[model samples]
Target chain A: MLLPYLLLGAILFVLGLIGFVTRRNLIIMFLCTEMMFQGIILNLVAFGRYPLKGAPTFDGQVFALFLIAVAAAEAALALALVVLLYRYQGTLDANAYRMLKDE
Target chain B: MPPHPISLSALLPELILLVAGCAVLLLGVATTAHRRRLAPWVTLLALVTAVVVVLFEVLITGRATRPPAAGSGLFYGSLATFVRIAALELGVLLVLVNWSAGREEERGEFLALLLFALTGLLLVAPADNLWLLFLAVELVSIPTYVLVVLSRSNAAALEAGTKYFYLGALSAAVFAYGLSFLYGVSGTASLAATTRAVVLALRDPNSLQGGLAMVGIVLSLGGLLFKIAAVPLHFYVADVYQGASSPVAGLLGFVPKLAGLIAIFKIIALTGFWDTENRAVYWLLWLLAVASMTVGNVLALRQTNIKRLLAYSGVAHAGYMLVGVLAGPLAGKALATDGVSILGNGPAAVLFYIVIYGLANLGAFAVLGLLRTRGGPCETLRDVAGLLRREPGLALLLALAMFTLMGLPPTPGFWGKFALFGSALTASRLTGDTWLIVLVIIAVLNSALAAAYYLRVIAAVLLYENDQPAYAAPREAQSIGALLCGFLILIFTFYPSGLMRAGQHATRELSEPRATAARTESPVASAVDPPFASP
Candidate 1:
């Protein structure tokens, strides 16, 4: 019974990883990371609700809460960086900022 | 259950950093005109105070035979004290370096962000729970992303911040995903409890629980490899280091990297993952060490840009540190015998190497910051040419730092590399493992390869002639900090025993309890089940 929920969470995680790697737009890439966070949150909540044995514990749920908080902080920073990049380069494309590379 | 009174003294250094950081932020707004002059002093005062507090903590711990009363909750052990003190001392140096090098406009924000990051680093050492560990890691990372952009408003700075943020975020997610799996299998977030659970699960290699725990370890560590700038995750380093201002780049080089190493060490200690029967983990770290050294050094050899060169060198250093990690007891079958432990030596070597590397790297970057042209900070090998003629003192300081990085004798870098490679050799001897001897050989060759590039920079400073006039002299504050770092490097080189003693103390404090815990737990597990003998 717990297997399906775990499998679903794993699928979401892999999907998020794929999206993050394949997507070129900076904002989209960040959103994909968020998607990955969501998947982790799902797994945490699922595990909290159903233990492998005995009664359910709140450890996983508490962890998921902290994860959400940290993820929010990360998102805020990511957006600010994105805005800074756009203001400087006038594009959200990752390839647009290559001034640091070696010739 | 009766509520436990929280020990505020345990959190003294971090609390000081937090209050000072917030105060600096407020001061930035209230006294804008005076901030450029006032902020750095305040930051320095806060850092000094925190350092004093850490020293006091260390002293008290040293005198006491019993475990510290304050060691129970968030803060635990002398390792925490040592790591915190080391990190805060580096923070003070960074503040001094950044004081004059950072633009006047962002002085307040710069100091404040740096303190916030230090607070995160300070929290990382003593974090008992995975939740706190994750939070501390983020706290360290987020402010750095902002600081990367705050150093300059140039396109490169912004791009560096963006690239750093994206990769950092991805790594954090990967870490979180791994943690969730760990939580699912272990059913707890406390590292001690989770370790027990993970060991039990791993006793059955074919079980679903065992498979999940292995996945969790890989995924979590895989994410952390970004901070260390190991291969496959080091692609962003050169660009980021080059984009950020030199002082910020120096902070980038050490702060997060040190925090990550300590955090990883804590995880390994708590999870006892190194001592597990899992040879896969050992092989994985071995592969990473070899790859990072080869890739970092070889790529570094061709780099014209000094920042890129240092960035790759930083990668290579991380590889060297990984060799120390690989030498740890986790990789082998040897456990405690006659209570004379070899387990802590690997971590001790790493700690010692970090202090040496931090001093040298920060000094080098400080010199780079000092040698700025009207165009901007010196970025290429050619820029440093004729430095010997224009500024002999700065040229010599840079040369000392370069030689230290190359691990030449009479410099602290030589001692650091010796200890690291020596520990690996010891571990190999203990385990009768030939792979570690091979690792030591690879590391030695890589250091030689690294010398080729480090020498090139040194040669440029001393040999090449430039008729162009000297750029503006470095600011007094930065020159002083650089000199102090150079002096410390020289002093530590001649008197290396003190640093080695402290490193051994920190490592012993970290591993002793775990050793005892394993000893007590193993007997019970072994008596009940013949197949599940604890290593």
Candidate 2:
């Protein structure tokens, strides 16, 4: 049962990683990162249910709680930033802003 | 000695910061009817308050204790306190430097994030358990992800924030993987117990768990090294600095790097490999220090953008400090002829160097923040050509910043480098290694190399023909802020004793000699081990 949850989390995380990397839309990319964070939560909760050695520990659950809080906070600010960028540049395409000239 | 609960008093500074940060966020919404300019000032007030409370706590409490957790309590002591003071002071200075930019948008979110980040760093210095360290590092880092994107008016700002978040998450994952390896090796995450296990592994190179633990330590360093913008992980730093405003760039570069370096110091110190017998730890840090210095300087040499150059320069500085940490751990014990205090001396030098470096870096960033054009902050070398004619005072401030950064005479930076180099030199002498001395020479030479670019800016301001470059106009706030920062740089040069004394006091707690210094000995040293376990 725990293994199934872990597998689900792994798939979600991979999908989110792909979306974040391949997508051009800044907001969608950010959403994908949040999706990846959810995957982390899933893994943490599953681990909380079934400890590696014996009895379940609260460490995994506490960590998961922090992750959820952080992710929520992150999404709020990230979305706000995306909105601000669109206002400034009139677009959400991540590729258009390549002004940082690398030498 | 038995287990005792972790003290809440030890966590007061973080509590104060969190409460203030939440207040700023709440006021961000509640004060909609107030003028937008009021929010940043309020945030600034909160930061100042946080600093005062931290100062009071450190000065009044004298010492705060953390209970020994199974995995994280090994990094506790004055070393952590001193580092927190240095890092938090940098955060406070950042608020002052970037006030001109933060005020322009009427956004207090930056202030809240800045306070929150400092809170995280404060917690990081004292984290004794690996799990605690993990949580604390995120506490420091997650807010920064928000800070990067809080000022959303510009395309560059948003792009920088996005890239930073992506990279930050990757680093965090890498860190977790390393931590997992550490947990597997020691069967416990506590640094005290883990050190014993690691020593066993080191003695027998064939040990799978030891090899895995080492890889984990290295991988954990990857995430931290990224924050400090060190070699192999520094690619993101230049881009992020170029895209962010000068103030954000300054905070992004300085605060996190200080936190990372302190964490690195704790990690190195706890591993028990700094002793001469620990050949592996010495070799690793020696290689890391040299690589960081050479790469940062060489890469910085080619940069035209001032921000990019500074970013690379920061990486180089981290390398130099790592050398000090290596020296402190590897040779301090062996060199203790007649109980001559080499242990205190090495770590003391590192702490002092951090304070001096923080001051000088903050001063430089303050001036750079002032040099912003109406469009945004200027990034190019050519943008500062005629600055001397219009703002001689600001030019002088930049000159002082450059001289200090170059580690030139009479400045705190000079003494700071002298401390670091002197410790490394002494360590090499005691350890019978010319290679460490060679690393010092490379560091000094790189300082000279650093002088070229720092002086380039000075020359551009003072000696270059006064042809007005684009966006060379100075705002009133920039002038005032530069003047204040200039005074600070100058003060640091003349009155270095006060800061040095503070740093010295901060390291006084961990300077004891251990009878059981060998790995086969007891897990925790008897010198300052408390009787209670943390609940």
Candidate 3:
């Protein structure tokens, strides 16, 4: 019963990681991180039902709830930063900001 | 399966900071100009109050033992007091470092956000639940991403903030993913319970639970690597450090790294991997330590920008602390051997090193923050040339900081590195792990190599001849802050015993219950509690 949900969670996590690494757009990369969070939250909730050891506890669900709140807070901060970056560069390209190099 | 009890009194400092942070935000947002001016002072007031509360707790809590179920609850005594006071003390230095960092309008937001972040850092030491730890760690960082941008108004600052936010979010997700697995392995979120689970799993050498724990730990470390700016996720360090103003750069160097180290200790101690001996976890930490040290030092060699140079140096410092983490706490063994319990306490050395490192780094940045070029801060090494002639007092302090960073004697940094690496030597002898000895030797060599760049900073200030960058509008606080850090370094160098004792008491049975402390009397207790932390 838990197999499909865990599989989906794993797939989403891998996909988000790929998107995060491969994407050039800053907003998209940020979104990819959020997607990864969603996957982790799903996995956490599923684990609450079918713990890997001993008797199950609702702690996984509790963890997922805290994680969701944190993710939302992170999203707010990420979007604000993206807006600031866009204002400075007039584009969302991650590579555009080269002002902080070693030279 | 009773619920772990929570201790609200142990959580007092955080509560004060939370209320004060909100008050500061409200004051900063008030329509009156005077109310806005009150924000920074409010933060200061809050910090002082929190420090008092923490000290009081230290007095009252006195080697306070946790309930047997505290493995799943917050640790309320020694370790909490150690980290909380350290965070607050250094936090005040951080605040002074940035007294006039950005425009006046940004000061309130900056100080308020800093208070919130400190609140999070204080929570990490006592956090016995994985979920609580994850939240606390995030709380420490999310505001800093904004604080970095608020530190300056330049396009570079904005860009730095953007990159910092993205990476921080990604790392948080990765860290949470790992936490989920840790929960699965134990079917509980309690750190001690997880360690117990790991102990149970290790009973069966071939168990998948052990393998699963390893996977969880690796991924979690992957996420946390961003905090310490370890090798794998250290790409953001130089850029973020270079982009932010010096005061914020100093803040970045110390606070997040401390949080990461504490959390790593908790998780590793959770698995009892250090004691039980897990090959995959062991070697992973080894690689991270070696790689971070090598990469941070090699890359720093070519950087001309001072902030960028310090940025790389910060990474290398993290690598050094990682060595201590890898060594784990050996105070128990040292007591059995020679009565010098401080000798082998790896975590104690780490605590001492961080305090010394934070002061030196903060002092250097405070000195830098006192002057600004047209491009912002004393950017290139050339800007520092003949600074000794132009500003003897400030230049001398910067030189002193560099000496500390180089771990030279007459500075506490020497003892910091000596104690840190000495613990590794102790670990090797106890474990009969010869590779640990090799690792310590390599770390010593890295310190030697680190001196070359640190010398360059001193040489620029004292040796080279060029027009020194004209001091920006002098802020007395920055100079005073720099001198204060330098003074503390000198004091610690002379009277190291006081702080060293604190580090020892703070580390003893830090993660384990009284049951574990009692077991330490036997020389082979390590045979029971043996390894901690991955690698």
Candidate 4:
């Protein structure tokens, strides 16, 4: 059962990494990255169920909680920037925003 | 469990900082919204008090009959002191430098974030548990992400902030997932225990999970390397630096990088990667370090924008610092005792290198911040032409910064690279590892390569004619900043004995006793100006 869940997460993560690298839509790339993070969190909580029996077992769960919090904060800030990007350039395509291109 | 760890007495300064952060938050809410300059002032006061308290603790502890061990307290020992002092110093500097940046409304949030970030850096080195490490990393990062967006006026600020957050979060997630795998194998987050478990797990052929876990740990470190703007993960740095406002860029460049470096050091120390027979981790660091050094330096050569150039330059230096991590405990021995073993002096050299790098880098940025134009700010290298004619003193400071970056003599950057290169050469000789020698060669060559661009800025400022329109000149405050940073650069070079002594002392206490005693009695340890060992 654990193996199957782990395999599923690996699939999702790879998919997210691929989309993030391949997709040119700035918003979609962000979504894919978020998906990658989510997959990691899923893997963590699943493995955390059987933490060291008597040694404060909630470490993984606590870590997961923190991850979610950071994810929320990141999303809030990223979305705000997205709004600003569209306002500045009138588009959200990664290819279109070449102001900071490698020189 | 386990006697509730240890007494929280060792955590006095951190506790004070925590209180200060809360007080600043409350004050921000209570006071008039526009008059938020008070927040930074309050944060500054709190940091001062915290620094004082830490000094008191250090004095008290040092005098004690039995000093606390490495793993004592919630977090105790000299390594804790080194980490805390570096973080706190940078934190104070960030607040001082960024004091006038952004609008009045944003200052409060900005200071609050900086204070919170410092708190995170303070927690990282002493973090015995994996949970603490993760928490500390996040605490440092979250506020920094907010700081990237604080400059409301710049379109680049908003874009940079967004990209930074997205990538930073993605990396943090990667770190967490890998951490979970390690926890599963060890059934504990204590770094020592985790290392033991990793060793046991790695030995078994059937433990594919354990092998995967090792990969996860390495992968997670990629996120941290990103924060430090090290190679491969260095993609975000130039853009972020270019996009963010000057003060914000300065903060991003220094404070977070320190935090990330400390985290990297702590994790490596806990894992005892130095003792392990597997050369895999060392090889990985070597490859990354070389890439970071070569790529960052080569790329920086063509940059027209000063900040973008510095950004790449900073990445290359991070690679050099990682060399110390690869060199490990004997470098500590070299610090605690020098030249006893050819293979081990790299760590002490690295520690000293970081101090010099931090001071020089911050001083450089502070000067750059002062050079604003009517077009808003002068980030491009062309803007600096003929600056020496108009402002000779300021131009000199820029030259000093460039010289330091190039690791030329008398500057801290040179001494920094010299110490590490010395150790790298010796280690390579003893171990017969040609790769280590190659790294040293690359490092030296890169320093020479860096001189081209670094000198170009100076040459343009001093020799080239100014064609760009000169608008309203920098005010009194800007010049003051320039003068202060310039003085610091000069002072670090001129009176190197005290700081070098302090750095040597700090490195001495960082490792085990056998290494310390062996190192303490060496000639190189005592000799201040010995050139690297003969080929």
Instruction: Judging by DockQ against the true structure, name the best candidate.
Output: 3
Candidate 4 runs further than 4 Å off: A25-27, A50-56, B5-9, B25-34, B60-74, B203-206, B331-343, B467-481, B504-510, B513-535
DockQ of each: 0.51, 0.19, 0.53, 0.34
Report the C-alpha displacement of residue B397, candidate 2, in angstroms: 0.5
Residue B471 lDDT, candidate 2, scale 0-100: 40
Q: Write candidate 1's Cα lDDT for B136-195 as tens digits.
A: 988999999889888876778878888888899999888888778777786666566667
Q: Which ten residues in a row have the lowest lDDT in candidate 2 chain A?
A: A51-60
Model 2 bad stretches (over 4 Å) = A1-96, B1-4, B31-37, B57-76, B103-106, B330-346, B372-376, B469-481, B504-535
* Candidate 2 accuracy as lDDT: 0.67
Report chain A TM-scores, every model. Answer: 0.94, 0.92, 0.91, 0.86
Per-residue CA lDDT of candidate 3, range B156-187, in tens? 88888878888898889889898887877777
Pick by lDDT: which candidate is best?
3
Better of 2 and 3 by TM-score: 3
- Which ranking of candidates, highest lDDT first? 3, 1, 4, 2
TM-score computed on alpha carbons, candidate 4: 0.88
- Expressed as tens digits, the lDDT of each residue in B1-535 for candidate 2 is 3333446666666777788777766665664556555655665666666667666766786544343332224334566666656665566566666665644444656677777888888877776656668777878887776676654356566678777876787676556545545544554445555565566666666666567657767777776777777777777778787777776776776677767776676566555656525666777777878888888888888888888888788878878887777777445445544443433256666777766666666666667666654465666777767777776766677778778878898988887788788878887777777887888898888888888888887788778765554343446554555566667677878987666665555544434413212321232222233222321
* Per-residue alpha-carbon lDDT of candidate 4 for residues B1-535, written as tens digits (9 for 90 to 100): 1223345666767877888887777776666755454777788888888887777766865631123323221344456677677667656666666766666656666777778888888887666567778778888887887787785466777777777886787777667766777776665555656666667665652667557656656866776888788888888888888887766776776677777877776556544565553576678889989999888988888899988988899889998888776766554453334523323556666666776776667666766676765556777777777777766777777788788878889887776787678777766665677888888888888888888888888788778888662232455544555566667668777876555555555544445522322222221111233122311
State TM-scores per candidate: 0.93, 0.82, 0.93, 0.88
lDDT of each: 0.79, 0.67, 0.80, 0.69
